[model samples]
Target: MTTTTTARPRHDAPAQRARRGSTARRETWGSAALLLLPAVALLLVLRIIPTFAALSEAVPLGSERSPWSNFAYIFSDPSFWNAVRVTLIFSIIVNPLQIALALALAVLLTKRIPAVGLWRTLILLPIAVPQAVSAIIWLVLLRPDGPLNGIATSLGLPTVPWLTDPTWALASIIIVCSWVGVGYWMTFLVTGIKEIPLSLYEASALDGAGSWRQFWSITLPGLRRPLLFVLVADTVSNFLVFAPVRILTRGGPQGGTDLLMYNISERAYTLGDTQAASAATLVLVLIVVAVVTVQFRLLPGRED
Candidate 1:
């Protein structure tokens, strides 16, 4: 018996193409995940595992529940509280100073100034130097009889008690940190500034905006996202700063520069109090998170 044969519609081609396209996307995703696996594994192993380990040490995780004595001890300790204040103040002052200076440099370098390229290279030299090295150099410069004091003596200016006094010690650390960090941060600002369309500036200028007005209306608004990132990241970085304090004042003449990281190290090593150290470290982490969250709330919207 002859059966009537019907041809398949041309819509079959589109269905087959759709299937191939889906398959291709799956392959692409598979390849991407394969490429990302190593980084994810390393981060989990190095960062996440150690973080949890520290948290466990601080909070006590065993067959039986333990009292939160670690947290209690750290919270009650006056030095730990002082460290908290010093850390917050350091971040408060240094982050703004660094951002302002970096933003200024970013704007300045974008202009047609003589030897501007060389100036940028010079400014970045401190960033290339290791933080430890930079700290040591500042230690030399700021010591009682160092070049800075010597110059002051020659010029008959009052020399700063940079390291010996509690008041000046923290300020000295902030100055050193800003010196090393501002140029590094300026690079980010420069990238953000460059990403801003020149057309915006031109349109503003045509509408009778002067340089200051343009900066406020155009440049500042355009840079909101970068400023937010810089603000948050800088605050975190400054909070965790340790090496400069360790090298310069060892957490102080009187705990003036007793920042959270330095305080944690002192607890861990000098006092042989690992539990307290872990607790303090966790507190530091919490403070950073809280401050950053506040910054996100306070700053201009990221989407804009």
Candidate 2:
């Protein structure tokens, strides 16, 4: 009887303490969710809603009102396919080339070259200039009577139609795009390179590895994650390229530089065909998704 009485004396104490702890955790989480709601709501309204709306417009149902006809229209048009091809070609050429050049430049900058800070600044200067402005500047530079042609003429070479000629129009677009983008992309590579542990390089040197060998054996392997990140980011950015095309080429010299984004913009704004534009956007999104999915799948241990 005495033992039972003693044990019953403090039964409410444990329950009370547990209730207080639970209440404290609930308040903490409630405050955190309240703080996060605004950002979550903004993203939903701006990004998620518009994406779904665009998808809806792309899908033509029946009586030509369905998304099927819209998709059919996009797929059936030879011009659309041409634009797609051009876009893919542009992305494939520019992204890899820029990445290679950027990596090279970043490595050079990292090597304590003379006036290194100055050189880095000069390389990044183009990024500070607006893309539209850069395109316009290059438009003048590449013109028949401009600096490039002048230089060629001084060297006893024939003047070339850099922008107007169909043969050179796409190439010019790619060059201009790379010029504007390479510096920006280089910054990312530089950051990734700087993050590598110095000990790895020292160890590689101790193993009698030359600079090139060290880069291949240690640097490249260390950069796998950053390289993947940059690759995906650059791919997406290159796929959406429109500024240079819009300002300098306008998808011209017989649409040689017509990218998918330019086509969508033309349909939506110039042609006032929102539905068609939305369909084009949906198609572009699908292509991007497919590319990214394939990339991640091929990457080791990336599934998680």
- The best candidate by lDDT is 1
What are the TM-scores, per candidate, against the unseen true structure? 0.86, 0.84
Instruction: Please write out the lDDT profile of model 2 over residues 13-118, one tens digit for every residue.
Output: 8777687668767777887888899999999999999898788777755544654877788789888998999988887788889889988887888886888878
Put down candidate 1 lDDT per residue, 261-283, tens digits, no spaces. 99999999998999889989988
The global C-alpha lDDT for each of the candidates, from Candidate 1 onward, is 0.87, 0.84
Q: Could you give me the TM-score of model 2 versus the true structure?
A: 0.84
Off by over 4 Å in 2: 1-40, 60-64, 300-304
C-alpha lDDT (0 to 100) for residue 60 of candidate 2: 50
Q: Name the regions of candidate 1 deviating beyond 4 angstroms.
A: 1-39, 63-65
